[model samples]
Target: MLIDWFTVGAQALNFLILVWLMKRFLYKPILHAIDEREKRIVAELANADAKKAEAQKESNEFQHKNEEFDQQRAALLSKATDEAKAERQRLLDEARKAAVALSFKRQETLRNDAHNLNQAIRRKTQQEVFAIARKALMDLAATSLEERMSEVFTRRLREMDDTIKEGLADALKTASDPVLVRSAFDLPAEQRTAIQNAINETFSAEIHVRFETAPDLISGIELTTNGQKVAWSIADYLTSMEKGVDEILKEKDKPIAKDEPKPEEPKPETKS
Candidate 1:
């Protein structure tokens, strides 16, 4: 190989100058543009990550809100259901009470009606019995009623005990007005005289006597003086009967107790 040092040296110097110019202008500019692009890409990637994170946070918040809304809705539904159930129970209780009250009222009305009917029947029976008794007595004693009654009055006066005699005597002595003798029928002169004599003998006192007929006495005699009265009447027996009838009817109207045992009737003895 021929040694050409000057030509080679000149070629080598020109090659170095070209490389320096390329590095200073093209390479450096290209490297800087690439670095800037890389930096921009990195910044964009970071921004995207941050945006994704924010989006994820927003999604989580939305999910939590949804859960909270669901819970509120469930609570509202439960509360509404409870309120409805409570209202229904309240109405049912009221209805039951109303029904019970109505039933009790009806029972009371029925009992009252029964009691009234029993009373009406009792009154009618009492009136009929009284009418029959009055008619029988009137028919049997038409002629001798007054005489028998006067004799009975005199007998009763004579039969007075010492206590009654003393009371009558005191009343006769204290009374400023005449003693009154009341009867259902007018007495004849003889009967009046007998009655006056009986009273005078019973009291052992001379007393003024006044006789009066009172139809309301109803086959009875009454002696009155100084607000004291001695009386006997058929009405007394009727009143006693009425009281007994009332007691029996009241017992019949009363309801029997469920727990109470009924009395058994006695059986007649059988012949052997």
Candidate 2:
């Protein structure tokens, strides 16, 4: 502890100078190098993170594109399916219409053929009916049938409706000419006298009478005055028979109806 002031001061000054040199030359350079290395590491980390973010963005874009493509594909498939179904339905409808038209045409042809055959049959039947009737009537004595017809005419005149009787009575009263009696055969005096008596009795009045023979009036007798007439004919009776025959033939020839086809169901499409 003996005080040596100069030596102590010199040692203290040298120590301070050595410290300054070490700090300036060694510590400052080391600190600067470490800071630069840290800055470079931080920049590299930031760049890596930016690259990773970009890759993630690219992945997202790819995924979005895939999703869009899938949606478009689905839409296209749906559209195609709808179009195919429409086309198929259209074709089926056309085919069905064609079949219906063909069937209708065939039915029409059959109807035409049936109508022609019916016409021919009807004509032949009418001729046969008339021929048979004429022969049978001819087989009966003409004078006998004509006498019966005259009797029927007198009965019909008596049984006439009130209006027709009144009309005929008025005509007889006003007519300038005598009431005319026509027959298919010449009436005998006795038959003419009977007709004249029957008419006068029916009207409760006396009237002039004339007799005529008409060859065209077959199995018929007619009485006329001032356009009023009363007559009966066998030909009218045969027409009803012809109509009934026509009805029977038409009923038997009607065509049978065919059943329509059912629509087809569409099958489900399988996934690819």
Among these predictions, the greatest lDDT belongs to: 1
Give candidate 2 regions above 4 Å deviation. Answer: 1-143, 248-272
Per-residue lDDT of model 2, residues 1-272, tens digit only: 68788878998998999899989999999999999999999999999999999999999999999999999999999999999999999999999999999999998998888778766776676567556655676677654555666677878878889999999999999999999988877888878988998899889989889999887664567889999998776545545655676687667655333345668888899999
| RMSD score of candidate 2 (Å) | 16.1
Candidates in order, TM-scores: namely: 0.45, 0.40
CA lDDT, candidate 1, residue 70: 100
Q: Give Cα distance to truth, residue 18, candidate 2, Å.
A: 99
Error of 2 at 218 (Å): 4.0
Model 1 residue 44 CA deviation in Å: 45
lDDT of 1 at 28: 99
